[model samples]
Target: MIQTSPKTFRLHIGIFGRRNAGKSSILNTITGQNVSIVSDIAGTTTDPVEKPMELLPLGPVQFIDTAGMDDEGSLGLQRLERSRQVFDRTDLALLVASSNIWTEFEAKLLEEIHNRKIPVIVVLNKTDISPPDPEIVKSLREANYTVIPVSTLSGEGICELCQAIIESAPDSFVNRPVILSDLVGPGESAVLVVPIDKEAPKGRLILPQVQSIRDLLDNECISIVTGLSNLPQILSRSGFQPKLVVTDSQAFKEVAQITPPLVPITSFSILFARFQGDLQTMALGALTIDNLKPGDRVLIAEACSHHPVEDDIGTVKIPRWLTKKIGGSPQFTFTRGHDIPDDLSGFKLVIHCGACMWNRRTMLSRIERCLRAAVPITNYGLAIAHSLGILERSLSPFPGLLNTLKTTRSV
Candidate 1:
């Protein structure tokens, strides 16, 4: 049996260009498959087409071929808008352009990519029909852009294009941050508390729990897995002292009570907040819960779309806790998957999920947006612990963040 990495673990490379610029063709040729519809028509690809595969020397990667940025008309504009959204998650961007053509569309797109601080490679496709313009090439080079002139018809520059992608891959992806391994040293042990609830999959542990266990094993650390019922037994052993205790956010209060105060503790979602996003920012956002007033608007964002169970964490539990904490019923708006509202100004606070389904870049982009909107954003785990008045205790493993929290709380 072969193991496959999840899309969230893969490098996200987005290919962008105007209509018929061979964006799809480049993807098909490089991947050696017809991943996208390659048509001469301007608006053939009305939505972003994604292809996930192993790119050697770069590991797993997902190539996103988007609709033309310069698309016109009512429907065309919609497609163009969807293509623009791809910028938020793109780790590496391929700005495809036809050789001998340098227009505002390509320039404006490049500017947008630059504004986001994303690494971009300029691919002047269709070089067989006409050579690349020297002035355009020189201008791009002067701006420190890697310019690759390619003719997919003749297989020219395909190898070089792949090399450029390999080189431009983000450092974060190459050297990923650990979920919890850094907290526990080699030969040390950590306890993982996973509760079996209605939302828990039939027989499988959740992604965060499984990944944390795997990360511990990979780092030569021992991982003790148990449910809320057995957590007490594991902690009660006289000679057994775990370096850390990680539990589901919902089980925070129980686990904190059972585990000794000397042992550092946290939740899987909180670990993910540091793994997938800025911990300090989310921690600060969690502190803003004290300022939430009655009738204040709150946005709950979930990365994975699913039907609501009876006591769904996002829909029921979090809202109930917030209502109790605020002593009033605040307006709660729920958004699942990629449906984050374009305008976030109406919301007083944005509470998001662990985002296990999304890459770090995507989560960071969302966090960045919330900051720009001046709205405080926090993840489910942080929000839960804070509302329960146990957030400071849950952050024990991360002393720097704990000290920061204490200082911020004093203010």
Candidate 2:
């Protein structure tokens, strides 16, 4: 898959439409494979279907096929919500409409796209069956939308459609990945500290750890791996003085204590902050730790869907650490998986997981929502380091940025 990594070039284009509007069919024709299941029934695709491929002019691209927007009933409403969720992360939106009908559903979706400032292409699908709608053409054209009629089955106008999508996509999303990789120069040494615990996957490293290592390798930077128990030893014995140390948030205390003040250090979560999320917003959220009232409500968010471990950081460890630091009991609400609470004003703060499995677009959208709501959102590592009273030390990696933020916020 083409990573939407800040180091790689990719365009995240999402395909959306009403039930069975040939969204999947259009995808199959474009990709030349049955990547998404096709069905006559509406709401067949409950979850967003993703595929990554290289288009000639566009280089690498990711396509997301979502469920119909007009789905009904309880289950359909849930599916509809899932489809809407894709909007926040999409760099480009393709609204697949049937030539037979154009309704309020498309208009509302377009309004949201406009609000989000995402460029869109209104696709009139199944053109082989019927002529274009005059009202649809007039309405969309007046609004300055590019509407193209396409036949997925007959394979008509597909080449032109692909070029149009490439033309409409933002250049920033395609180039963000490359900028992140350029932050650290080639041939420098970086250390990664990963702690192995019950929550840590057995016989395998987490996605974030592996991806960071791979990114370093790709840039020709030398990396040394160590566990929390022997991080000090690893630093002492390594041949070179490491330029950066990346660690798991669970081991932030020990890592911060052992590492010398000169050598830069940070967590995998911090790297995500700089690359996948808004670092400034999270920095502000971390500052809210001092003001958490005794009875104030806090929301703890996690992304990966699974049976949380007994020592889950998001559930047990983080809550325990915060309560211990505050020295008072506070109301805590836990929302796991994708069920994030809509009314976040009830909570004073929202502490989110590192979001290893989710893409950058989704993470930023979640942060943007928190910004819009005026609710502070900090991740597992920042919250942990903040509560432990060693945030400045934990953020030793980017001394310039970290120290500047820490110095300004320190009381």
What pairs collide in candidate 2?
6-177, 7-177, 7-178, 265-396, 265-397
lDDT of 1 by residue, 1-411 (tens): 988887779999999998999999999999999989888887688899999989998899999999988899999888888998899889999999999888987899899899999999999999999999999999999999999999999999999999999998989989999999999999999999999999898978888998999999999999999989998889989899999999999989899899999999999999999999998999989988999998999999999988899999999999999899989988999999876889999999999999998889999999999999999999999999999989889899989988998998898
| Local accuracy of candidate 2 as per-residue lDDT tens digits, 243-302 | 877788888788878888777667887777766777767866988888997788989888
Query: Which portions of model 2 miss their true places by more than 4 Å?
Result: 1-12, 33-62, 72-76, 100-105, 133-144, 178-183, 237-239, 403-411
The 10-residue segment with the lowest total lDDT in model 2: 2-11
As a whole number from 0 to 100, the lDDT of residue 305 in candidate 1 is: 88
Best by TM-score: 1
Q: What is the TM-score of each candidate against the true structure?
A: 0.98, 0.86
Look at candidate 1 and tell me the lDDT of residue 352: 93
Q: Give the runs in model 1 whose Cα sits over 4 Å from its true position.
A: none
